[model samples]
Every structure is written in structure tokens, then in C-alpha cells.
Target: MFSCSTMMHIPTSQFLKLSKFKPIPDPRCKTKVATLSMGCFWGPDSLFGSIKGIMRTKVGYTGGSEPDLPTYKSIGDYIESIELYYDPSKITYLDLLQVFWNNHDSTDKSSYRQYISAIHFHDKEQEQQARDSMKKMEETKSNSIQTLLMPYKTFYDAENYHQKYILRKYKIFLESLCLNDDEIKNTYAACVLNGYLGGHISETEKVRILDIGLSDEQLRYLEACL
Candidate 1:
């Protein structure tokens, strides 16, 4: 004969699992900031905005002398540009360093779309940390490390309308509130190519240039599939 024991059920807050996403003091989030330049600011802004503990995110030009200027045309674009704010408590600045590696193609051009990776940190330790991570990424990742580590310049907050672009453009975020994390990441990956951008990608292939970048490979793959 087996005896059954009563198990006490503890009411746990959903916050336990998503603890990394806990709301931090963004207003006083004095963590050192960093800037990046990948491509059209809309996608980068949208992707990073969803990340928790990001005090703020801004889009603009960098790696040039005109810190006060706003230049969008890639025709003669000289500045590599983007801006991001993070809370060090939840995510370290180094975590962002790795993020920069995965998100863009550094082989395009020095100042071209997702060509160079640059880090703008405030102090010696932070710079060292970013530099170390950059080196490590170079050794580990298939692509060349084009991320330039430098002092941060002025940050030009994108136009007021551009803020929260994913929320504004996709018309899905409002309802995403009803979903969970895995659901949300999947939704994003699925809906990423919706409409014109959809139906292009073929099945995964064995021949992918891990070093170059995904967008170009993606376009080629889709074309072959079609």
C-alpha cells in the first residue's frame, strides 16, 4: 500500500521566470551608454526596443565629424550611425557587444549598410570590456570583426514619429500583449517577411556564407527557391 502526501502549492508571480525583464530604474539608469550603426534604423530600433532594461534607443549618424547633422541619404553617407541605451544591472554592456556581432553584416563596407561595428563607451574599463568582447567575437564568429571601438559623440534622437516604430508600423504589437515570450519571438520571426517580404525565403540550404551576412544570402536563397 502506498500513502499519498499533500503538496503545498505556492502562488508564484510570472516575474520569476522573466526576471531578466523586470522593470529597472531607467530614469536613473546611469549605466554607460553605447552607439551602433547597422542599417535603416527602423528594424534595429524595433528589435532592440523590445529588449528589457533598455533605458532608451535612438537612431542617428556616427563615425564622422558632423555629430550635430542628420544625414539620411546613403548616396554620400559618411557617418556610421545608431544609438542605444541600456541598464547595466539587467544586461551588461558586453552583452550588447555580442548583440552587435549577430545583427549586422560587417563585410559590406566601412560605412556601408551594416559594414562596420563601432562601440562608444565612457571610460577605460568599459572600453576595455568592449574591446575584449570584440576581439573574442572576431575569433569565434565566421565574419570579419569590423566593429570599431571609439569614444561616443553626440546622440540625435530620431524624429518623434520614428520612435516605437515596430509598434507603429506592424499593427501587431498591441495584440502581442496577449502573448508570451516564445510566442512573441516566433510571431516576429514568422511575420518578419509578411506581404511583399514573405513567400521569398526557400527552405534552409547547406551552402550559407556565414561570414558575409543574412540579408544578401536570404535574397539569393529566395531567388533560387523561386
Candidate 2:
């Protein structure tokens, strides 16, 4: 399933009222962009969602010689990847490349088993670019970048149940966490989370309901989202 960045809900009217706070606007990303696989898509989606320049992101399967559709039950059968649609005005491919390096452990190749931790690159340019970016990161950040940058192949869309996982979980999670804000519907992002939270039982549902880890307000937030 796809991971999601935090999308807090705020009503449109109230959101406008609070616009004085200058919340980070959605990404200006406008091109068809792709990134290879990692262990999971949810966390990656969540991480990317945190960035301001991203417009939209999708989670799917990539790296196999042919298109490989990964089922939730068969998640292990495929490599987890993401396809991002972004506005070039907000973030550059170079910028997203940096994120790719930062988000996952891309330090070795042979050790990166293709069946499992194999990090594939979509093209020769992207492969080389990843290497170049790693070098730059090493020289400037005092560290080396390492990841298996393989070839571009095919990508298959995951099942519908797997899409927007975090959003769905966010709703149920908030209800369980009690992290609710009554003004949810007014804001786009938060509403997304709220819709998800309210719509389905999160993959983490059993544990959350079982754990007394939330504060009063957090519990309220969860309730509010639900």
C-alpha cells in the first residue's frame, strides 16, 4: 500500500482565516516522474508528502522485467516504488533525487538483493545521476551515497485497497489517537486524512486500539477525524 504524508484537515473558511499562518502550499510538480523500489511504499509516500514541492504521488511496482502488480497479500512478490507527478516550478528532479537518497539506504549493490532490497533506477540518466548526487552528497555532507541503481523496466499499479493507505489509516489512527480537529473538512490535506481515518480500519488498527498511548487531546483528534 502507498504511504502518505500528513494531511491535516481544516475547513475551507477556517483555513482561509488561518491563512495568515502561511501554511506550506502544495507542490508545483508538473511532470511525469518515477523512482524505483524500496521495502515499503507507505513510509516513502509519507516522507515525500512532507516536502512542499510535490504535487501528487502514487505507489506501485517497478523494476521487474515485465509489469508486476503487487497485491497486499503478495507485497513480497514485487518491489515497492512510487511515480510522482510534480510541478517543476516547485521542485526539480535533482531535488527529488536528493530526497530519494535521503529516504532510503542506498549504499551497496551486490549486497542489495534484487528479490528484496534491490534499489532499481528507471534509466541510464537516473542511474548516473544517482551516482553523481551521491558523490556530491559525500563531498559536501562528508558521507558517501550507496544504493543499487539498476535498469528501468515496467511498473504495475497496486490494488485499489492499497492506494492512499496512510489517509485511510490516518482517519482510523486519529480516532484511536484522539488527535482530532473539528474543523477538518475545511482543509484539503487534513480532510484527506480525515476521510481516510473515518473510512477504514488502519492496518495498525489492532495495536492502536490496544495501546493507551494517546493524550486527551490526541484522543479527541482521533474522534474528530472519525
Error of 1 at 144 (Å): 2.9
Model 2 lDDT tens row, 35-112? 655556655655554454454556677665433355655544456676665556777767887777665655433232
Off-target runs (Cα >4 Å) in candidate 2 are 1-29, 66-69, 75-77, 108-125, 137-146, 172-226
TM-score of each: 0.55, 0.54
Off by over 4 Å in 1: 1-31, 74-80, 110-115, 170-226
Number of the top-ranking candidate, with lDDT as the measure: 2
- What is the clash count for each candidate, in the order shown? 3, 34
RMSD of each: 17.8, 11.6
Report how far residue 123 has shifted in candidate 2, in Å: 5.0
What TM-score, to 2 decimals, does candidate 1 have?
0.55
Report the lDDT of model 1 for residue 189.
27
Per-residue CA lDDT of model 1 for 1-226, tens digit only, reads: 0001221221222221121112112255465577776655555655554454455565566556543455454423234355666778878777776666676664444434323456667778878988787777767767675656778666555454444433333333223234343332223222222211222223442122221123443434324433
